[model samples]
Target: MANSNGSKAAARDKRQRLTAAAAEVLHRQGVERTTIADIAQLADVPVGNVYYYFKTKDDLVRAALSAHADHLSLKLAHLDRDPDPRARLGALVASWVERRDITARYGCPTGTLAVELDKREPDGIDTEVGQLFRTLVDWVAEQFRRLGQPDPHDLAITFVAANQGMSLLSNALRDPTIMIREGERLRRWLDDLPT
Candidate 1:
């Protein structure tokens, strides 16, 4: 029984490592350019071992997208600790500012992946990738609703759209400072929203 438990633990650990490495590689290389070999090397697992956990590259990509969705959900949920809706929204934007360097270098990880996947023949991953945005927009809209905004849904979509635009411009310019500046602008915009 002890040996079985140990084996299970090891298997879980290795699968987690592979998923993390897959997310990083998918983000950095985009799906078309990343391979199972790249994911295995990044995870420090033998290339063939990756097949044990993921049968196909698309399977790995789906895993990465699922992982990202969980991450985004947790991150947004974390913002709920702040009592003020405005502050919570600011916190969400500030989280992006905190990763400006990475965003500038590689673009928004989810955004880039979604664009890459959409450019290809309609793969099922697009819906998965899109859920991340939908989740985000829903959370933000909920915050707006809590603040008694009449058009919470529209406001949420606009806010997310602005952030994506900023991310795109920041990547194009290779300027992390753009995120910082836009974050500050968003803070002001958040403040100015009708109470």
Candidate 2:
């Protein structure tokens, strides 16, 4: 049992290393140019080791997306305990930008991964990425529900779309200020929503 657990842990570590490599490739060269060899080199594992863990490049891509999304989920989960939905919305947006810069190292990995994979075939990790967006949408919808809105789901989608749109534009412009300004506006609008 101990050996089994140890093997699982080792495999998990290896997977993380590969995912980190994928992120490095995606960041330095853009996803289209980044290749399995690039990731294997970054991870310092034999090129064969990559295939040992991930079936294909798309698999690795999805895993990378899932890793980053999980990180975001961890950051967002605690907001559920916050009493004021308005305050929660503000904090969620603030944390999204702050964490994106800090953890992502390059930028919002979510956006980059989505753009890279959107043109390709769907796979395991794309669902995880889709769910990440759904998470934000649901969070916003929950806020709307708290605010007595009739359609929390649709409202949530708009809120998330606005947030993602802002982030995408901010990344393109290479301006954190855009995210801050637009994020603040979104939060204020949420706060002003009638309860």
**TM-score for each prediction?**
0.98, 0.80
lDDT of 2 at 42: 84
Runs in model 2 deviating more than 4 A are 1-8, 27-29, 99-107, 121-128
Error of 2 at 178 (Å): 0.5
- On the 0 to 100 scale, the lDDT of residue 126 in model 1 is 88
Which predicted model would earn the best TM-score?
1
> What is candidate 1's CA lDDT for residue 119?
88
Query: Candidate 2: minimum summed lDDT over ten consecutive residues — where?
Result: 99-108
Candidate 1 residue lDDT tens string, 1-195 = 999999999988889989999999998888889989999999998998889999999999999988898899788778888899999999999999999999998999899998999988886788888989999999999999999999999999999998998899999899999999999999999999889
User: Residue 31 in model 1: shift from native, Å?
Assistant: 0.8
Q: State the lDDT at 80 in candidate 1.
A: 87
Q: Candidate 1 has what TM-score?
A: 0.98
Expressed as tens digits, the lDDT of each residue in 1-195 for candidate 2 is 999999999998888999887866775566778889999888888898889999888777776776666776776688877888778878888876664443333455676666666667765455666777776677678777887888889878877777677777776766777777777788778777777
RMSD of each: 0.8, 3.1
Clashes of 2: 0
